[model samples]
Target: MYISKKEIEVRYAETDQMGIVYHANYLIWMELGRTALIQEMGFSYADMEKDGIISPVIDIAVSYKKSLHYGETAIVYTWVEAYNGFKTTYGYEIKTPDNETALTGTSSHICVKKENFKPIQFRKYYPEWHKAYEEAKK
Candidate 1:
């Protein structure tokens, strides 16, 4: 897999009263990981919007393993888990400095028209994006 690594520092605000990172914060980290992976492929969501394209998450899932507390550093491993004509799956692994997994997740998204926010086939309008998805499959 072509993994994009991003370091995340656990902050007090990101944690709940129990000191463990808030569950919802993981979703934000997932987005950060996805953005990093896409940028690594030489593209940006901004550029996509400029081209009148939009990609919104259609489905998402997350699994928490170890608890992460404030002051610890976590690494997010992100990649294109799978893709097809209209859907793309981005997978992520969030771990601690010692490489212990804190979370695992996947987000499924589809490219769509910004004006209508309607789903569109990536192969037709975003061949480069589709090409990246295809190459990543290997």
Candidate 2:
């Protein structure tokens, strides 16, 4: 599988009262990872939006394994876990500098029309991207 990596610096503002990274921050990091993977695959979400197509997360699941502190760097690895013409599931792993997994998750998304919220067939709408995801999943 082709995995894309993104490095993010943990900011103090992203931490909670106990000085550890808040759980909600993982969602943002996952997005960063997804963006990196899409860019690596030579696709741009902005371009999709321009075409009146919007990809939204239909489901997500995350598991936290370790705590992260401010001033630390987070390494996010992302890949297409599954693609089935209608839905694409992206897998993610957030790791520490030592390469230990801090969080693991998957986010499933579906493409929809911007005008109506109606789901669109991804393969028909973006064959190239669909192919990329299919290949990446393997």
Which residues of candidate 1, in runs, are more than 4 Å off? Answer: none
CA displacement after TM-score superposition, residue 87 of candidate 2 (Å)? 0.2
Residue-by-residue lDDT tens digits, candidate 1, 32-129: 99899889989899998899998989999999999999999989999888888689998999998889999999999998998998888898888887
Winning model by lDDT:
2
lDDT of each: 0.90, 0.94
The positional error of residue 118 in candidate 2, measured at the CA in angstroms, is 0.5
lDDT of 2 by residue, 4-105 (tens): 999999999999988899999999999999998999899999999999999999999999999888999999999999889999999999999889999999
Q: Candidate 1, overall lDDT?
A: 0.90
